[model samples]
Structures are given as C-alpha cells and as structure tokens.
Target: MFSPFDSILAFKTAIYFFLRSLLKGFLRRATGLCELQRLCYANNIGAKRTKGVEKSILLSRCPVLKRINTQLDALAEADELANNWSTVEEAVEATMVAKQINKSIHEAFIQPYRICLVQIYGYRQLIVRLDQIRGIAFDHNNEVHLVLLKNLWKLLCPDTELEGMISKQWTDIGFQGQDPSTDFRGMGLLSLENLVFFATVYTDHARNILSHSLHPIHGYPFAAVGINITHMALSLIKAGYLKTHLYNVESRIYTVEDFHKIYSYLFASFDKLWIRSKPNSVMEFSHIRDKFEAAVVKKLQFEDAVFRWDPYLETI
Candidate 1:
C-alpha cells in the first residue's frame, strides 16, 4: 500500500526525529540540564509550561518515567483511587533518579514539574470518576436515585408539586415523556449530576436558561439538550481538548465538580447562542449544538484559555 512518495516521506520523518534527538542530547550535555528542566525554565507557569513538561516526559527514553505515566493511566482505567499528591511526589523522585537529575542543582524544576504531574494525573483521575458516575444507570427502584431526581425538580420548580413519580409535569422541565428515566440512557447519571449542579449552584442562571428554553417559537427540550451538552463536555475531556483550559485554570487536582462546572458553563453559553440565532424551531438543535462545540473547541486551542461563568454576562 505504500507508494514511493510515501516511503520517501517516512524515511525523511525518521531521519528528522533521529537528528532532533541527537541535537537534544548535544544540548543537554552543553547546558547541563535535561530537556524537561530546560523547558520548565524557558516557559512560564501555565499551560505552555505544563504541556512542555508533559511532552518531554512522554518522549523520554527512561523506563521508570514511562512506567510512572503508564501506572497513572492504568489507575484511572481501573477506577482505582489514590492520593494525587503522594503519587506526584513518588513520580517526581523516581523520574529524578531515572534521569540522574541532581536534586541540589535542579531544585527549581521540582515545583513546576510536580504541578504538571498533578494536572496530568488529575485529568486521568477525573476521567475515571466521570466514567464511574456515567456507568451508573438511573434506577427507578433505587431510593437514592429517586431522591436525586426529585431534588432536581424541587430546585428547578419550587412552587410546582409533582403530580406523581411519573407524570406530565416532567415534560414541563424538558423530559420527552411522562417518565424522565428513559432520557438518561446514553449519558446516565452524569447528565443528572450536571443538571442538578447547574440548578442548585446557579439557581438564577439556570432558571433564566430554562425560561429561554421555554420560548414559544424557539422552545427546545431543556433536559434533553442538557444531557446532550453533558455528552459534549465528556467528549471534549476524553479527547484531551480541555487540557488548555484545565491546565491554565487548575493548578491542583481536577475533580468531578470541575467537570460539572464546565458542563454548566457550556449549557449556559448554548442557551445564549440559541436565543441569538433565533431558530424557527427546536429542529435546528443538532446544527446549533455542533456549531457551539466547534466554537468551544476553537477557544480551547489557545494556551491561555480559561472558561468561567460570569453572572453579569448571563443577562439576556
């Protein structure tokens, strides 16, 4: 399947990497610092610095360093929780030993490298936590799940009393049918968690957005669109597209709460965009959703990107 041009290009790429590695080695000996340390010193604190360190670590030939990265990823995949700080400390010490980095001379690299590790592994842990929550299907038989479902209703519609466990009132808040459980199929409890967090934490904003969703002409299914936004957030996180925003904003460990914040922001932003565009009906949701996602992805391509919900900006 390989054409002559393709073979030539592959050979050229290989030679380029080989020469680049040799150059890095020569520079390391001359500067008396590893690639990571040099990068840490060159770049300021934030996404650029952290991303540089991450790249250096991933490209490292050191077995211990590679194993540490593998182990962190494996921990997330297995849904095994561990103390992030302790893990970072062990990884830093192990990486130093593997690279023969002198602690006395390279003490400056410690904090920055540690921060990068925290962000790196913290992201993995966040993915694990999200997957664990998303895996739990909403159960009507479960008391806790029922309580959460009721709580969401109470937060959104305080004056309205539920007619029953399953009723048309559910449709008032955007459920497709009398039974709201079916709407949570793909996203599972993660969707519910995101919705509840937005309503509970940002009551006024959530209400305003809900009001927008009820627009007679442009009305859309509130809960359904929220679940769709949750899916988008999860996709962005898993695809590593959120790293620029996360790295710039969170110096510490990332959590499920952080993810909820992201989802809420997306939901609110989507509401604003929806109103501005003034679609004839809810039928345009798929196109608008894709447009919104593309915009978010574009914003996240910048190293300085940090998304936060501002109450003042929510006025529409």
Candidate 2:
C-alpha cells in the first residue's frame, strides 16, 4: 500500500522529532543544574565543578565558558603557590585585596544577625540599668536629690512650705509615715524620681490629683500610690511587657523618660478612675489600685499603645 520513497520520508520525520525532544530535555536539565549551582553558592555551600568525562561535556557548549572557567580556577588557587612576602610584598598586597572583597561578603552575610544582636544587647542593657536604678537607696545626704525633692513638693504646694521631714503636709501628700524616706524602702530612689518628675513636669495635673486626695470618704495617699505605680511600671519592664508601649522595632529606647511618662499617665488615669469608681472609703484603696493596674495592663497589650497625658489633664 506504501511507496518506498514515502517510507523513507516517514523514517526521516520520526528521527527529526526524536532529536528535537532529546535536545529539549537536555537543555531543561542543563538550565536546572545551573540554577542549582547558583543557589548552592549563594547559601555558602561552596561550588565545585564536575570532573573527568562530565567536565569535558559540560564546558563544550561555548568557547567563552571554557575561558571563564580557566581564569576562575587560576584565581582561586593564586594564593596557594605565591610567596611574594620579600621586599616588594606582592603576595601580602594580593592577600589584602582579597580580604577587602571578602570583608564586604562577610558583612552582607552577617548584617541581619548583627542587627538582631544589637537589639538584644540593647534590651538586656536597659533591663540591667533598670535593675540598678531599682536597687539604689534614697541618699539622705545627696544635696541635689534633696533639692529636687524639695522643688517637687514646692511645685505641688506653692502656698505651703514643707519645713521638715515630719511635717503634716507630708501626711497631706500620703506618705505612710512621718519620714517619707521610710516609705522609699521598697522602691528606692526611683520612686522618688517618678514623683518628682510627675510633680515638676505636669504641675497642674499633679496639683489636681493632690487635691483629689482629700476626698472625704475616698481619699487615697497620693505619694504612696505614685510609688505603687512605679512598682507596676518596673514590673512591666522586667517582664518585657512594656516593650509594646515603650519601644518600636527600629526606634531607640528612652528608658528613663518612658518610665517617667508611665508614672505620670498612671497618676492621671488613676484620678479619673477614682472619680468614676466612687469608692466607699480609703479602705478600698487596694481594690481600686488593682483595678487601675488591670486596666493599664489591658491597654498596654494593644500593639500601638503609648502612655500619654490624659486629654482632660492636658487641658488643666
């Protein structure tokens, strides 16, 4: 049924298709192997060429490829056999140049890790400093600290001058005892600093809160409450909870100022909470303090939380 010429043409057509399919498959494998080698080099796996018969077949495609391979091989081994460390120091010069190139590669590799390390180191250093601050005793003889404290008291009570440590104004501000230093036992000088910062920076709001401490049935000890708020702030910092409010990924940590801000916010927030809660008596202080702390912790859990002046307090 078929002519001999037609049979010969069909055989040639089938051979053509077979060669084309083989070539397509070989090209795909070659492309994939090249990609794989590049990936290995990128990940520092080290690149090595195939040897023996495979090496000859691999580089047979283009003359440019063979030349590049020869140059690269020569450069890779140049440091091994060279000893130009005499008067000229040519080998030393070559080594330095290689190191310069290698340094850039090393920096590229370790940059992310270095950033992570700096962040972790900065955080740990902040915590250590916080701990150190909390452990410091309120020095009675430190004239500067004493002057700061006096200024704070004066700012709060411009009309009444607190002459001695055992003044009734001390009780008016809510110290637990005649000497305010006795109450600083738990929080050390840090609590005093918080009080001074709040009193000095936010004078009107501080005075308003001081006035609210005189509420007939629900009066709370203002200074004692401030110290407790400082404790809360420190606890949050130590537990890493304050990072949500105190830090951003790329921002520097302002540990002292941030803590002072928290203290001020606590005072303002507590005053508002106290007015709303309308507690029966001063005996309810612990219950109110706990409720206020819970509220603070809840707000700080939010991703974008920041302790700031209350809108109403700012107006005052």
Best by TM-score: 1
**Candidate 1 on 1-316: residue-level lDDT in tens?**
9999999999998897798799899998999888888888888778888888788778777788889889777766665535445666888898888778999988998998888887887787898889989999999999988988998899999988888879999999999999999999999999999999999998888888888889899989999999999999999999998888889988887889999989988999899899889999999999999999999999998888888767667542
Candidate 2, position 2, lDDT:
93
For model 2, how does the per-residue alpha-carbon lDDT over 1-316 read when each residue is reduced to its tens digit? 8999999999998897677557645854775323222222343211121111123223234353344334333432342111221312332223224323243443342333222222323444565666676788877788876776688679888998788855666877888877787788898888988899998888888898888888888778888888888888788777766665554323332356667777787778888889888988878878988898888788767656666565453631
For residue 150, model 2's alpha carbon misses the true position, in angstroms, by 1.0
The whole-model lDDT of each prediction reads 0.87, 0.62
Off by over 4 Å in 1: 1-13, 79-81, 312-316
Clashing pairs counted in every model = 0, 0
Residue 107's lDDT in candidate 1: 94
lDDT of 1 at 52: 82
- Residue 213, model 2, lDDT: 86
User: Which residue pairs does candidate 2 place in steric collision?
Assistant: none
